[model samples]
Target: MTLRHSLLLATASLIVSATVAMAQEPEVDCDNAQTQMDMNICAGRDYKTADNELNAVYKKALEAAKETDEGFKDMGEQYVGAVDALKRAQRSWIGYRDGQCELAGFEARGGSMEPLLVSSCLADLTRKRTAELKAFYEQEN
Candidate 1:
């Protein structure tokens, strides 16, 4: 690649990673997000928070199922199936979320507002997934 192309690629990678990193950190002030860039940052941050909670809840649910399995001497197969199903479901959900958000961003594709649209869709989906995982964690209680 030409130097210019290489630099452009590197800059794009950095921008994407930085947006995700900003979302993962707890420093974005959504209320004061006055610019399109700031709004995108805040939306991404929200998605990251929700996604984190979903992971935590899923882990707990799996752990709890494993613990419960001890009560049944021959239920190892059942436990494995349940865990496998949850893992598969989560993978599918992630693919769906990403595709859905990418499509939503088409409304402003290549525009300054595209990131905000994509991030907002991601946050919405992540929150729903969080609730679903939380419910699963609580269901066995």
Candidate 2:
């Protein structure tokens, strides 16, 4: 009933919870993820890798778009330049990706596998988008 006792109980509960959590957590092996948590973690890592590559390629695409727009600068306000068009398309693509991934997660619904599904979808979509951006940049170059 005392505040001191309450604080002590809370602290003990926290410590116990932390210990249990640590015990339950497995060492993730992405190559052969067996547990749900490990699979989720691996899927997240895949998404991160794809996102990083997408970001790098996107920067290159932006730069290429800028270069391409240089010739159009003289056309004044009448033209929608390459950089502007690319930015607009990229923004739309991001929205589409997030929505599509969220929809993919619905297969798992409220289950533990939802995150893994969403992450895998994101990774796949991001890699595909990165390829598209790379191809656009190459074509423009």
Candidate 3:
């Protein structure tokens, strides 16, 4: 092969090796995150964990609501039953959470910290909601 062709091939191999190394980078240690990007990523991960927890609790709550609705099924179409009420409340809560987080992010609006602010707010609110849902059901047992 020509010298120029051989040099280009070697450079391509080096670039691919660097890409592979970056792709295999170690997971971030959230507790010791030092950079703004790492903190933002950690915050996002926290929110995801909280959200998953909330979803599990919400499913239980929804099932309870459905069971409650079975008892009130004869109340007629005019009356909103437990399932409907719970669904409405959950939808409203989601709207509130999103809006609140958007406002919280305004503290660092248009900056790199905005994502961290939003994600942190989301995680906090989601955890609180999960607790509330648990309390609501726990009261019955």
Compared with the true structure, what per-residue lDDT tens digits does model 3 show for residues 39-102? 9989998999999999999988888877676766688756547778888999999999999999
- Pick by TM-score: which candidate is best? 2
Query: Which ten residues in a row are the worst by lDDT in model 3?
Result: 71-80
Model with the higher TM-score, candidate 1 or 3? 3
Collision count for each candidate, in order: 1, 0, 0
For each candidate, give its TM-score against the true structure: 0.72, 0.80, 0.77
Candidate 3 lDDT for residue 103: 100
Clashing pairs in 1: 23-45
**Candidate 1 lDDT tens digits, 1-141:** 999999999999999999998667455579888878788778877777877877788888787565555555376555445566677898999999999999999999999999889988988898888788778767767
Model 3's alpha-carbon lDDT is 0.91
Error of 1 at 1 (Å): 26
Which has the higher TM-score value, candidate number 1 or candidate number 2? 2
Off by over 4 Å in 3: 1-26, 74-80
Error of 2 at 87 (Å): 1.1
